[model samples]
Target chain A: MVIERASVTANELIAEGIFQMNVSAPKIAGENPSPGQFINISVIDSWFHPLRRPMSIAGREGESLKIIYKIFGAGTRLLSEFPVGSFIDLLGPLGNTFELTEGATPVLVGGGVGLAPILWFDETLRSNGIDHTTIIGARHSGEHFLEHCPKEGFILTTDDGTVGIKGTVLPTIESICLEMENPKLFACGPEPMLKAVKQFAEKETVLCELSVESYMGCATGICQGCAIEHKSSSISEHSYHERFSLVCLDGPIYNAKDIRFP
Target chain B: MSCNLTVEIAGVSFKNPIFVASGTFGYGLETQELTDSSSLGAVITKSITRHPREGNPPPRIVETPSGMINSIGLANMGVERYIDTVIPRIDEIGTAVITNIAGFSIDDYLYVMEKLEACKAPICGYEINISCPNVEAGRMEFAVDPELTGRLTESLREVTKKLLIIKLSPNVTGIASIALAAEQAGADAVSAINTVFGMSIDTQSRSPYVQTNVGGLSGPAVRPVGIACVYKISRKVNIPIIGIGGITSANDAVEYILAGASVVQVGTANYKNADTARSMIDELELYLAENGIENLSELTGGVIPNE
Candidate 1:
């Protein structure tokens, strides 16, 4: 999993602060980055911090892969300024791939910027021809990616009723689950939202998977920088694994049951 | 035909000189699915102490202007458990496995080395890490003072017959003196230029970026300083120098080798690029081949006199 130096083929200002950059790397794009798998984009020339920001692959368009991101900090600001044709290093297709259960209807839930991973997952589910529904939520209507959703079976929610339903995506999911029996949930969002969804679902009936976020270094699972603590009863005699699991290696994606969300 | 890039540091001969730094490499076994460990010069395991450490709390790392600040707190599986679990698995890799030992006391250092020496695995060498700042004691403090560095190096030297390479702290005032002291204390080699102490502050929180207040800085921000330390230490000591800091490209590595480093380790670069070490090896070979240099040994301090 070498970090290949990728050149930005196109940088388009998609919306207000958000910019979509397409990088030219067929080998990495062809690596078949599944849903929930992220590419760590090196922000600036030499500045390492904000360490490498993990950007979910927005969509694959030919040889170039798209990353839709907002300018949050110095790292993202630098990333936004990456002139077209400039080289940016990328450590990819890193982290565990999202599990695809056979013949299971996936209810993709994404909130705010967390919607990044769900877009890829939606594409995956569509390709597999698995019946799926998406519940996308944002703080307000302006932040919604309603246009990006697949043509069929999509639900939209916003904090304010300027556009979709006037609540979080959880309410929409709750309503959907009540109507649909035994729907598999695949979610990536803020911890509170994911935890709420996990608690709402019947453990046996609904197999839920969630992608957790953490600060990372050595995105290739070398540095234990991005580790999440898992509650396990069985303690190993060795000193390594009494508590935490690395987010970079063990998973960016884990069985919703395995994680003890904070 | 190009020659194989092999070098000897602290009496341990590596098939190449591009070993991963302690913390950045994790345990060699973790990367088996991603990389070919056998192709590396050596896989230096994360710093192991006498007991298992849980490491620091959240926000262990933050990115700086051109580097990253890390306060990892030297998290490891303790020496005994590492030998029991990690060493056995590493032996299967067949390449040189260097155990990086970090301790809070002289006894802790000795105990770890004694345990590692007893392992059935072909323990290539012991990289004595006296540079970890996150630890409250027995780390950067030992290397800050030349006499303390010498005493600690001597104590560990007495217990382990295996090759001893003291990893020197760059945070110290006189890095060359520390390197010289380690060499005088019977250390087989000295690894110069560990992380420089630095911190980033969060504007919103109005406090330090890392919970541990201060952290070690590594990346391109520290390359010039690393190269300077290697050049200065290489001039002061005859023992081989394993230069490490912000080596990202082959040119960065070449600069260190020409600065008199016999070998170099890629640390922060590995975080940016997983195949940094192998790519560096390839780039170095290409540089040598292009320059008509026959052997890597010829490049050690190969920098021509500026005059």
Candidate 2:
């Protein structure tokens, strides 16, 4: 609740234009922002605009929290430009957490900036001693940076034929499906990718949890800025299509079956 | 010691004066775990309409100097769905539930208000939104024209006996004249200064920063402007003024009340800190008690004129 201005103790360019920064927020890290939960990092020093940039918790090192971000626009670009010691205001441990399934084989899928969530997922599964398989995909080889991929079954794919596989990660997933036993797919990526995975994956046998992105005002549930429709059976029973849920409140994570995407 | 902070708006009293703004608070249900809803005066629901809205495209929000720009498109479930799913859960909180209604037309407003009237929750009042920018018609038309403002208020007055508060836009040229029109039209109160229309551009890309090209700006940058508007309108109208805009602290709320706001709404502040309004109200009560003030009304319009 206390929005603090923490300093960036270290900044590393993990990939070209992609930076991973550790911020000094012992209190925040101690509180433990859950996987799939995000933090709002202030874009600039002044209070000209009230909203904060929502970023996923990459991993938490001792006495600090890690945020992996790519320089996309003014906010991210400005964020990347912050010197190591500059103070950055943050509002965090926000939104709902990814519901961890007990004794389930976790398959983590990430694409581009969406990779941030999976990183936390990997750390969480590792800590819990849950076996997880991470499949990461990028546009090409230049963008494929999976060095931080935890010691689990790692699958890499690129859109261009420059990496492990030539086609999409979905194809790689299908191939893996033939070899691996019943695995729960946890995916966060572009909508098309998630949709493709959702369409192909076995819905009943495989529990799929997805992280979605939307235009938001308050990263918190207020504002109704980030809402996703939830299909209801009662509406179908009544011969009406009724659904309701908010991404900021209900989840940035949802069972793949529950989401009715835009 | 317990922090006793309570304030009243209209005839409905609040446990505290820190109520979340209409669009920012969504329904109280969304933030159940983040903050205690019962601790505040009221939770204003997201702006509801006769029909559901998908809202604007990507990049709906952009960060400004000390504030942020948002074009959230006032997305929400239709009134019927809201009453069924959202309202029933509100009573558990004990805090007053204020519903915000928006429409594409006067008829749409009347329909939504009628639906809200049917809800069982303690609908203390209605905040009629006539200034949301993301919508194509309806809201901006009523807000920009004084005559249209009067008509909308008059229609709302006829349909629902519940106290009506008209939220005015700050984007217009003559906000005072519009506020005067609302008073003439029988509005119970007026909440001012929605987001100011603005945009930020990415120099390198030669494109608008937000996907929506332009959005409404809120935060500290707009606080002074909000205070100025509240002061001007409070002087012009007899109705109690509910000040909103860039209020983030107890001093900001105090400044608005001193400028003539009977109550204040915390919007963008909630985004920055979920407990902002409650903390602000606590701070305000402490300031009042320390100064030996008993009632908040004593500080309303307390500003001294320059000699």
Task: Please list, in the order the candidates appear, how each scores on TM-score for chain B only.
Answer: 0.95, 0.94
How does chain A of candidate 2 score by TM-score against the true chain A? 0.89
For model 2, the stretches where C-alpha displacement exceeds 4 angstroms are A1-49, A60-65, A71-113, A120-215, A227-262, B1-16, B57-59, B118-121, B132-140, B202-212, B289-294, B305-307
Residues B1-307, model 2: lDDT tens digits: 3344556655667776677887777777766645777777777888888887766545566666777777777767778788888777777656888898888788889898887776544688898998742244533567888988898899999987777889999888889899999999999888998888889988888888666788888888898899999999977988888889888888889899899987889988787667778777778888888877787888888988679
Model 1, TM vs. native = 0.84
Q: Candidate 1's residue-wise lDDT over A1-262, tens digit each?
A: 5467898888877655667888997778778776788888878755455367888777776667878787887788888888998998887877787776776667889876777788778887788777889888877767764653435777778788766777888878887766776677888888888888888764445788888888888776667676666767774653464567778778898888787754
For candidate 1, write residues B219-266 as lDDT tens digits: 889989998998899889999988888888788888989998888888
For model 2 the interface RMSD, in Å, equals 4.9
Q: Whose lDDT is greatest here?
A: 1
Best by DockQ: 1
Model-by-model DockQ, in order? 0.41, 0.33
